[model samples]
Target: MKLVIGGAYQGKRAYAEGHDSIQKWANGETCPEEEIFSCEGMVDFHLYLRRLLQEGKEQYVREQLIPKLLQENPGIVLVTNELGYGIVPIDPFDRSWRELTGRICTELAEHADEVTRVVCGIPVVLK
Candidate 1:
């Protein structure tokens, strides 16, 4: 799998699109949980996580969804916002979401064949 990450509006989606056609989920778009494994690529995955969190499926996302997606689709490209930097959120759930996103990114980065960070529209390959 390939992982693309950066701050919000940093052009991560644009960069990923330059490489392949991607199915995007953003701003609370409904994620078809059963169909994600068949996707070739996905963008704004953080929003999907947020949805899962809203649905009280955060544990399932952390423990099962991502692993199953990767196992089922070996070459999928994933684009997510980097949410761990800057001031910490005051809301407990916000803080937890940031931490969760970071941990997920770290895990994905470790297993990804390539990892890229986009900053100000420029993509820097990290691994």
Candidate 2:
């Protein structure tokens, strides 16, 4: 798998699209959960984690989702925002979402074949 990360509006999706010729793409904010495993690429993956948390599926995401994705679609590319930056959130759920996104992205990066961070539309490879 390949992982792309950056701050909001950093053009991570465009960078991933330009770098890979993936025909099918899913938006994590709206796509069905099962679609992620089969899509060629996905964007706003941090939002998906937020959704899972809001739906009370945090434990499943923490325990099974990543492993399932790796086993089922190891070639998929994921584009997520780096959510741990900036001031901490006052809302507990927001803080949990940010933390979960960070931890999950870290795990994904560790296993990803390539990892890229986009800054002002410039892609920087970190793995």
Candidate RMSDs in order? 2.1, 0.5
Note the Cα lDDT for every prediction shown: 0.81, 0.94
lDDT of 2 by residue, 6-76 (tens): 99999899999999999999999999989999999999999888888989999999999999999999999
Q: List the residue pairs that clash in candidate 2.
A: none
Top candidate by lDDT: 2
Candidate with best TM-score: 2
Tens digits of per-residue lDDT, candidate 1, 38-102, equal 77777777777776787798879789876887789878888898888889999998888888888
TM-score of every candidate: 0.88, 0.98
